[model samples]
Target: MSDWSPLHDAAIHGRLLTLRNLINQGWPVNIITADHVSPLHEACLRGHLSCANVLLSHGAQVNGMTIDWRTPLYNACINGSQECVNLLLQYGATLHPESDLASPIHEAAKRGHVKCIESLAAYGADIDYYISHLGTPLYVACKNQQLDCAKKLLQLGASVDQGKGLDSPLHVVARLFSGELVHLLMDFGANAYAKNAEGKRPVELVPLGSPLFESFLEREGPPSLMQLCRLRIRKCFGIRQHHKICGLLIPEDLKHFILHL
Candidate 1:
């Protein structure tokens, strides 16, 4: 195996001073290893924000992709490095690279990085961006049992019913016997009767006679009037203003109710 270069070593080990010194001495900041990995990718994958900033300052390619098609932003999200993610975004890194598996949002959701999800969303990442292997970010979150990430996506207007084949988000949660996820999805208006490719609704995937199974059957009924009203208000606000609805002049309880605060 080829040894890591000095810049890669500095970046991966979080040695900001050494990295800056190397850059100042006219060392190439964008040098790649045998694996086509850049110093910026190393700093980001390891969550070394200072090393990453120094590398970027020295003119490192912010959107450099590895041989496997992972960008620095994607690496940062995989490691749940919020600071690294923010730094890369500030340096004009592409929010959503056309990658093989998932985008930054998918990486964050699969890893349960709530702050990373929020940062990506704030920077205009496509909330519903889908990967063939992972479905949507929300679908990946539910499949990976990342409740907070899934909830955040729902709040940001990610469709809860999206998925391919036998694995809609609701169907995946049902197979895993996650009652809490089921309730949360239902609260966000998931279609319990929506059939998968195998012609099986989510309830059929649940254990035959458990309380969790019973809950799905109970939830199959139509939503209450209050839920319908909340859904309409949320639809009116849409993704851009759902989080901002609290600032409007409304009843305090209603504000909390609307935002799910």
Candidate 2:
């Protein structure tokens, strides 16, 4: 799916020795194809750690941009390589994208690469970074049915209700009628009654015979006390502070209760 040159071919195929030989022969580590794709992007995109290491050592542009504005870090995240993500960050790879569609964090979340998402967040990437087309990372995770990515984004304090325009994360997950996703979104403060562009609530999206349909009908009338309490507790702690529940001097069971474990 990537346009490549001879150097790109070597690095992308994990040919560490061949890559080193090419660079030794005065081939530019930063050589770009007509499309501005670098060997580093190719190496990281294929998750060839050693080849990437060689290229970086030879002064490859860590933040090199492709014609579409994709950087090596974004390519690394697309490859789902947490190590490569860390490596580029160490080399000062920018977490922000020149193009919204090229965002490393959104790409990671959309592809269900939870560790890659975590790495990006740990390096100060905006967890709730919203794009004009992709919404937030949480919404992308939800729309793709990537439950783990959605849960991790929530834990890292991504806004659950802030999705593409009127479409909340809840709105996307409800269309799938996935009970697990619905429960996770609810736990993370997604609005059950949130409306989409079509003015349809999440519950309205489910088919009648779907297991989630009657379950929603049963619970939609009144908020459960436990659910209300959970919300209140999270509100008190705010977003990221919720992750600190593990470090609190509370009973283990109480900590689990707070974490919805």
lDDT of 1 by residue, 1-261 (tens): 135788889999999889888888877988997777999999999999889988898799999887788899999998999999999999998988866554888889999999999999999988888778778898889988999998999999887788654578999999888888888998988898888888998898877899998897787678999999888888888875686787789899988787766
**Residue 193: error of model 2 in Å?**
1.5
> How do the residues 1-261 of candidate 2 rate in per-residue lDDT, one tens digit apiece?
235667888988999888988888988888788889888988899999899888888898888788799999999988899999998898899999677769999899889999998888888888989898989899899999999999888876778799888999888888877789988887666777877889899998999777888767766665777777766776778666777778879789877776766
Write down the worst ten-residue block by lDDT for model 2.
Answer: 215-224
- The numbered model that scores best in lDDT is 1
Q: Give the C-alpha miss distance for residue 63 in model 2, angstroms.
A: 1.5
Residue 207 CA displacement from its true place in model 2, Å: 1.6
